[model samples]
Target: MPRARVVINREFCKGCALCTYACPRGILVISRDFNSRGYYPVMVTDEEQCAGCGFCAQVCPDVAIAVYRE
Candidate 1:
């Protein structure tokens, strides 16, 4: 299986948690650091575990996540 890389545009994230819930691998998490918008952004806990399913990107209303398979 190809490894996945998940990138979250922290500046655009709104702390919605939709991506976290959408991730089947449970690799997405809300970070403690706040972006310029004062919102907690999502982070990929383990890119190696990602399935590249794009569920997070699909559910993100802000369109902040990008998933790539390698």
Candidate 2:
């Protein structure tokens, strides 16, 4: 299956976890595993559910989320 293009910049992410809350489709979440900064990393659990609304990107104060439309 083709996947929706979504990218998260872990380095730029301050682990605010706002993306997980902003996603209407419940596609984004905070990882149990920590990133380099010891903050829980955010991720997309289901890409197909993503409507490409860019809510995550918009809510991210750190500009950590990027979504690509296919």
Candidate 3:
């Protein structure tokens, strides 16, 4: 069995939350804390739910999300 993970670039994240909506497994969420841009960034609640579908990374306009499966 392999493990899956999702990485988020906080500096580059504008917190539009498009990635959260794009995730099919409901693993992504909007952080309560706002980023420097005053917006809530996307967060991965659980790595285990990730299927490495890359929906988050693909939907991110800022290119701040990366999904990996190992």
lDDT of 2 by residue, 1-70 (tens): 4246679997778778888888888888887887788888788888878778888999999988898876
The lDDT leader among the candidates is 1
lDDT of 3 by residue, 1-70 (tens): 4388889988788888888889998888888888787777878888877889898899899999877887
Candidate 3 runs further than 4 Å off: none
The global C-alpha lDDT for each of the candidates, from Candidate 1 onward, is 0.91, 0.82, 0.85
Residue-level lDDT for 19 in candidate 3: 86
Q: TM-score for every candidate vs. truth?
A: 0.94, 0.86, 0.86
Model 1 TM-score, 2 decimals = 0.94
Name the candidate that leads on TM-score. Answer: 1
Error of 3 at 58 (Å): 0.5
Candidate number that wins on lDDT, 1 or 3: 1
- Residue lDDT tens for model 1, 10-67: 9999999998888898989999999998999999888878889999999999999888
lDDT of 2 at 22: 85
